[model samples]
Target: MRLIPNMISSLPSSLLRRAAFVVLIFGGLAACQKNDASAGQVTGTLNDAAQAAGQKLDQAASYVGQQVDATKATAQQNLDSASAPSINIDPAALASSAQANLQNAASTANAQLGKAASITGQGLEAAGRKLQAWSAQNATSSASSSASSSGSSSASADSSDAQKQMDK
Candidate 1:
């Protein structure tokens, strides 16, 4: 008791207040240090979780990128194929070919008619028959122009048949 009294008498009020403040700060620090271990563990767990989440995000991004690339490649291939020449014949070309074949058939049949007039009845009958056949073929081909893709082939057949008759 006497020692306490002597110390209080020796210390100024300002010094006492400063000393109390320092003690309180140290006491709070000591209490916080006691819980530091658990806090450190929680911080480490949070860091690991964040790392795992980052890896998952990276994987998802990579997968999406691969899918996008595949889709682009497929689209490009479709575009290339669409731009390629088709196997189907042009409608205008088929009509032109059919018209030309009909003209040729008519000219040839007229020539045959002129020759048949010089020849016998049998020659005239054959030439008349060839002309009728050519007319029928042309009619059928013209009617079916918008209906089928084989119009060009049919026209070629008609021209060949007319040539065969001419040869005969």
Candidate 2:
């Protein structure tokens, strides 16, 4: 401390004023440099936050794309299932079965018609025989009744003639 005072006392007033001015300028420059460093740190933090936001957006976009792809695939699968082809139809066999059924039905109907015709023929023959027998019976009964009536009428005539003779 004694040396510092002795050096100050020996320095000229003009030189001391120049040295103080130099120290003040250096201190101001250091403060400005510190402020610049803080600004650089703030800028770096903002850049980091922006990068994080960009990354999140990218992730969201990727997730949406995946969902779209999944939905599209499911729709395609549903369409495929709906439009699936049937492989069990056999046209030739179906036609043959139908023809066979028709033939059987036609044969059954023909047989039934023939039976009906035979029964009808038998019924007509029986009716004709019955009618002939009934007609013959009626004819015989009418002939006998007419003969009896004629005989009675002749007897009545003879009685009337005898009565007339007696009266006379």
Best by TM-score: 2
* Cα misplacement distance, residue 85 of candidate 2 (Å): 5.6
In candidate 2, how many Å is residue 162 off? Answer: 37
Question: What are the runs in model 2 whose C-alpha is more than 4 Å off?
Answer: 1-87, 151-168
Candidate 1 clashes: the total is 0
- RMSD of every candidate to native, in Å, equals 51.9, 63.5
Off by over 4 Å in 1: 1-37, 87-168
TM-score of each: 0.29, 0.36
CA lDDT, candidate 1, residue 67: 38
Consecutive 10-residue window with the lowest summed lDDT within model 2: 29-38
Each model's lDDT: 0.42, 0.42
Name every residue pair that clashes in candidate 1. none
